[model samples]
Target: MDSNLLRVPDGSESVTDADEEIFLVYTALNQKPTDQIGPDGFRGLGHVDSRKDIISIRFELTALSHPTSSLSKVAEDNLASKSRKGKSARRTCNHADAPQTIEIELAQDKTALRSRKGDTGSVLWRASIAFAQVILQQHQFPQSNPLFDKDLLRKSHILELGAGTGLLSIALSALAKSYTATDIAPLLPLIRKNVALNFTGWTYNTRLQEGSPGSNICVEELDWETLLSLPPARRSHYYPKPAEPNAEWDLVLIVDCIYHPSLLPALVETIETVCTAAKTWVLVIVELRQEDVVREFLERWLSKGTWQLFRVEGLLELPYVIWAGQKGVP
Candidate 1:
């Protein structure tokens, strides 16, 4: 809940202003100390800082779940009171009483799904459950559609749909000249926090080695399920005019957003309505779990030639499919 701002060093080319900001915000959220200087005199927590051009942020479980003074005392007392009848007894008691920390990185451009470790085939972790891991993964794979090409993105106006935690949007904001980021109303606070944390100290001087003049990034509440039926009063909260139709986005992005079978149709309808003819591309990156449901949805909607399916490599080395609109076809 608390936040802090740290100034980036001038001679530091290994990390950008954005990387430092994210690191600080993440450390604060996990309730960890940030002023500790490492052996190299640089602030060290858990991320890889070797890359001079790219800013990499690392998340560690120990940093996220450091035991409080009272909790530590209780654990110590419990361990001390255990009887040493035998090595097995001591080991068993220690294992039961020991505290475990679960740490993860938030590098993904979209912070909507969490990465899992081991073969613990229990329920898969999601963005809502592990915010840190999802962010980390999104950063590693910012784009869902590799076929779209970098040249296409350079010239197009982009929109990120269901932009949870605003990681992809932030990436797009850095790449595209104009970008609009939208998600459910409830997530705006986190999205804004992330945007501010990443962009506050960023400068766009041509001489700066790390980042270009940052893009014009704006975050708003645009519910894909609501569409034009959204209340005029509520819509006005983010948009300038609620009644007027706005044709602003040329490309739409949906990352890790296709789990619910019922929402696919509504989501498509919203895309068709908001995006104009100039908006010829839609990138959807999702980890296919329920193939039956996804196949049925794609066969019904994508087969119509309105959208085309292309496969892209995911950050976790998984296969992700991207859906783009046909030029002048839809």
Candidate 2:
């Protein structure tokens, strides 16, 4: 990892520059070969020998989007706090107490996005990209099949839970009839920004055949744990008031959200509530970590018999499991 990638601003402590740099390095090293080239030039050699029938390998790294000038001002404000005083302040001056700053490239893919240091509050998880690609592959959009096939992509209302940067939802929205992306309140602005950045100058009419309906995509604030707990009137406060009451989603997407042991039950409950009316398909994308927490959670769901889980095949460049679910109850 490059040490310069880890330099934080002068005074911010919420996230260290080192943290950003380390995350960037890990993401870059782990991305699929199609995504980026390795720092050492081992091009797309996944468990294969270097001398094996070597086709021409191309090395291309995505450009990182620089943060706006305003970020520097925010960094200054976060670093220049005069709260420290007296003897304790002197003890804290041993470098650890200084504010840390990291320069981040905005809107880069998962790999480059991790190197950003700021209070953006958006958490980028590698599993999300893996799952998103899986979903795209399953539907065969912008690749094998046509764009707006009603049988495959259209008329499917998709909802992305905890959509940190709304990447998956953005792709789905481009293919599906409608998409609703949600996350915690803190992440809404960043999600919207990402959506705008990717969708700018995007023309779907040319891609789709004549008479195919366009996609409708919107970002909203939805705390999954509290979604169904709210009263009908209160629900409107969080979600937009649908013109009709039967506007249920056809699919629900969640990525890297089941890590916490306690969160699984709440997450399942939230999925059950939101997916009540429609014959919904739930797509969960998760990465296998050292801990068995995720595996245990899946087992609990399996024992209940309310849901069916199938692990979809993934690409060599991505480390993700695609667990797809259908209507388990009626």
Candidate 3:
């Protein structure tokens, strides 16, 4: 019964005017009530008593997203201010050889932002940011690590799965010869928008792969479920085959994708399929939240025969691992 749930007790029936006021306060604060409905088949918003509490919640609503209300006007103003700042950021980036700035429009201001409950893919997860940091550190000191060997960046074709906000992919794009970010179809536009916003300097040559622009980075709709249902030969199609005659996906990057327990097996299968060639290497980073789900992924991944796992002992300040395929198996 978290506050976010906003559930009425099971015994409650019809919502009174007072009950409506409480529900109004809940929703007005940008909190969505659960699917539970009241006994009388109305919204399950039962009754509420404290007038002072309702007033306090009402005041808080101004900071949240509220359409058709005076509070929405404030939201608009804040976003306008952010836009001006965004322009300043772009100008500063152009002047200085600064790292590309990825503007994640949080639900508070951005039109593309969606509530986590509605679309978890739209939010910028910490794991994604941490993974990006790991890549930067490796790139800065490539000589120290064999995983990021001198030639890896120039020749590598990178693919990121469950790329929320496309942050990690965007960061890696500047390094890899080619990078692909994949998520569900609905999230493609938002991902593409983020790519275009950040990589303004990147060449827009879509003709890279045999008449294909071989764009440095691409955002494609790759439904994991669809891949899972495909025939065995076709399943490999989703997993990039070895491009350099010997290696499969010079490197595969995945972060924060193991939360859902049900999807663990599919995710594992996907990873195993992609790391088909012995030359392939996969770098996986999990945020370490949801201990149970993390445990499940680790157990499954540890037991999988496809990869010769290297437990990256504190390799990056962030959490991640490397999986090089079985030693010498063509």
TM-scores of all predicted structures: 0.47, 0.53, 0.60
| Every candidate's lDDT | 0.39, 0.45, 0.47
* Winner by lDDT: 3
Query: What lDDT is reached at residue 301 by model 3?
Result: 65
Candidate 3, after superposition: displacement of residue 157 in Å? 0.5
Q: What are the runs in model 3 whose C-alpha is more than 4 Å off?
A: 1-80, 84-118, 141-143, 201-215, 238-247, 317-330
Candidate 1 global TM-score: 0.47
lDDT by residue (tens digit), candidate 1, 140-199: 233342233344445456667676655555434544545666776656655655554455
How many residue-pair clashes does candidate 2 contain? 12
The clash count for each model shown is: 16, 12, 7
- Tens-place lDDT digits, model 3, residues 180-262: 88887777776765655444433333333332222467777777777777887888766544334654565677776766788
Top TM-score model: 3
